[model samples]
Target: MSFVRTLRQATAADHEMVDAHYGGFALDRQADYRSFLTAHARALPAVERALAEASDLPPWRSRTALLAADLHALDAPIPAPLPFQPGAAAERWGALYVIEGSRLGGQLLARSVPAGLPSAYLAAHHLPGEWRRLLTTLDTHAAGQGQAWQDAALAGARACFALYARAAAIA
Candidate 1:
């Protein structure tokens, strides 16, 4: 099986749990929207920082500023970023998978947000074909790397999901 598919299958439960936490927020309501943005603010910055520091993955624009802009528009304070430091290249790839995958959902979620609310973060969809490029990169990295790399990737993805879950719960 392709590494991306394998990773997805392994982390399905974690992804679903994180979705449940995020799905509970009613984005139409301003307060709920603030909470939603707040929850993301708590996790994304830290993850992006860790990725920037640890990996030489393909260049992708950071969504941290976009998230901050959304929070600023809501007059909601950007919460302290949750600490996240992926320990290896495989682990960083795993975290990146979670982060990039969220953007697909974010596109749909952005539509439900009230018309006047800021959604730069949610609306920050990948440039054309970006997702495919990322998947290719992931698969290339995992090719012949064997089970140890896969395990680290799974651990990284699970840890990332937990971070988002924790941030959501706190928000």
Candidate 2:
């Protein structure tokens, strides 16, 4: 299987758990919207920073600022980011997978945001073919690496999901 498929399979439970947690927040309400953005604010920055530090991946536009702006528009306090540091190249790829994948869901979630609410974060999406490019990059990277690397990537994705879940619980 391609690395993207492998990673998705490995993280299926984690992804569902995150979705359930975030789904509890009804984005139609301003208060729930604030909490939702707050939850994301608590996790996204650290992950983005870690990915940036990894540095070998393709250029990524950080959504941290967009997330922060959404919160600021609501007059909501931006929570401190949860700590996340991906230690290996494969691990970083895993973390990036979770982060980037969320954008796909965000496009759908943006509709839940009621009229007049800031949705720049949810509206921010990868460019056309960007996701395919990312998948290709992951598969290429995994092609030469052994099972240990794949395992690390799985672990990294799980860790990232855990961070988001934690943030949701707190929010």
Candidate 3:
């Protein structure tokens, strides 16, 4: 099976759990949205940093800055001390998959945000076809490796989901 397919299958439950945690467009209050962005801001930078160590992968563009700006715009207190640690490059790619893919959902969530709420983090700097491009890169890179590589990637993705779950709770 393709790396993307395999990874998706392997991480299906983790993906569902994270998606459930977001709870769609139900965040009617600014406080709720603040928590969402805070959780992402807490975890994304660390994943991006880990991905940065991999020369084969494209440079990671962090949305934490935009998330912070959105929090500030909404007068939400920035969550303190995002203490996430990253794994090796292959593992980090799995984590990056989750982080970068969030933008796809962010676009959907942005549309559901009630007017008067800040959504800069959700709507930040989107480019057409970017997700597909990144997926292709990841798929191509992973396809060349052995099962160990794919397993590491799967583990990384699962770990990221759990991390996000905890952050969401605290946020």
Can you write out model 2's per-residue Cα lDDT over 83-152, one digit (the tens) per residue? 9987778788788889999999999999888889999999999899999888898899888889999899
Q: List TM-scores for all candidates, in order.
A: 0.97, 0.97, 0.89
User: Tens digit of lDDT per residue, candidate 3, span 88-163?
Assistant: 5678888888888787778878887788888878876447777788888888888788778888888888888888
- Whole-model lDDT values for every prediction: 0.91, 0.91, 0.76
Model 1 C-alpha lDDT per residue in residues 67-106, reported as the tens digit of each score:
9999999999989998898887878889999999999999
C-alpha positional error of residue 100 in candidate 3 after TM-score superposition, expressed in Å: 1.2
Local lDDT at 158 for model 3: 86
Query: What is candidate 2's CA lDDT for residue 126?
Result: 89
Counted clashes in each candidate structure: 0, 0, 0
Query: What order do candidates take by lDDT, descending?
Result: 1, 2, 3
What lDDT would candidate 2 get against the real structure? 0.91
